[model samples]
Target: MSETAPTPAPAPKRRSTFLRDLVIIVVAALLASFLVKAYLVRSFWIPSGSMENTLMINDRVLVNELVPKVAPLRRGDVIVFRDPGGWLGPGMGDDLVKRVIGLPGDTVACCDARGRLSVNGHAVDEPYVVLSRGSDRVVRDDFSVTVPAGALWVMGDNRYDSADSRVHGTVPEADVVGRAFVITWPAGRWSVLSRYGDEWDGVPAP
Candidate 1:
């Protein structure tokens, strides 16, 4: 009788080294992103209509947290800051965003001879001002005040609906959080926020 050939031994099972490496890579990436957000930049979401026509409700903004450490805030810069007058109310949190209209030691007023806002005796043409709801009306209120030293005068674009400097007075410089640089969400609306304008350029320094 012929002897049967011995069956070959089954091959040893292999380890899933690829999957293990992939998991490690993903974890590292997430950690790096968190560090950057906490120290360099942060994402903020708009919760009200205060900055309408410029930043709408639910809009996503990118703030450069490192900016305050590197440079001083300038006129016309949109900034996120802590509430100064307790206007946000208790348990309502503290952060709010508004446009910088007057710097320390500068005089700011509303409703010039042409119904425009003025800064440091110069009339400012604000094309971005949002009109009141259901009417072709602009905020024509008369107000005049000098921004105190180490403070800022800010306001919202939607003047009729916003409760800002007009109601709370000036904000201390230390209250400013950071400068808004970009709108990143709602893919179709992505754009860098610009701080330059004819009026902004002509604003006199304190």
Candidate 2:
């Protein structure tokens, strides 16, 4: 009667090997991250002040690689592209980052009466452009051009210092690597890269 409780089934053996499980999980996570970086997103660091307040030197950013392929490029998008040709001088990198100012077929001009850049007769309010020492105009020089098919006009937020479309010429869309959507470094400076949507509201289709 005190027949003994069938030796409590040896406490069910733990099926999970702790160390092995952990290692497997870690490996999987790293592989997934690698895949994403390779095809979907990638990281880049700013090397100059061309993007200033929006993207400071050494600031890290996450770029969406599908842009212009899966996702359409917009006028205010911050993009990274390879030097089309002669865009970089000796000692400089082959890549550059700039904001999209004109799309293919767009008529882009500088300095309306208010010194704001114009696209298709609409004056763009660029709150992002930084004035250089003693400079009041966002764009100091006057120029006008129509973006060619399969090309994009780009410029830096630090207009005075950047040698962008104004200096080198329109970048072929094929050369664009990606669009920068966020700033990810210098924890204290973390922020989403803004497109300043309203600024392009008045711009007409190219």
Task: Write down the worst ten-residue block by lDDT for model 1.
Answer: 9-18
Angstrom error at residue 85, model 1: 3.9
TM-score of each: 0.80, 0.87
Residue-level lDDT of model 1, residues 72-111, one tens digit each, is: 8888888999887677977766799999999989999777
Candidate 2 has an lDDT of: 0.89
Q: Write the per-residue lDDT of candidate 2 for residues 1-206, one digit (tens) a residue.
A: 57766675533344356667888999999999999989899888899998987899999999999997799999999999988889878978878899999999999998777788899988888988998677667888899999999999999999988888988889999999999998889898899999898998679996
Give the alpha-carbon lDDT of every model: 0.83, 0.89
Error at 75, model 1, angstroms: 0.9
- Write down the lDDT that model 1 would get: 0.83
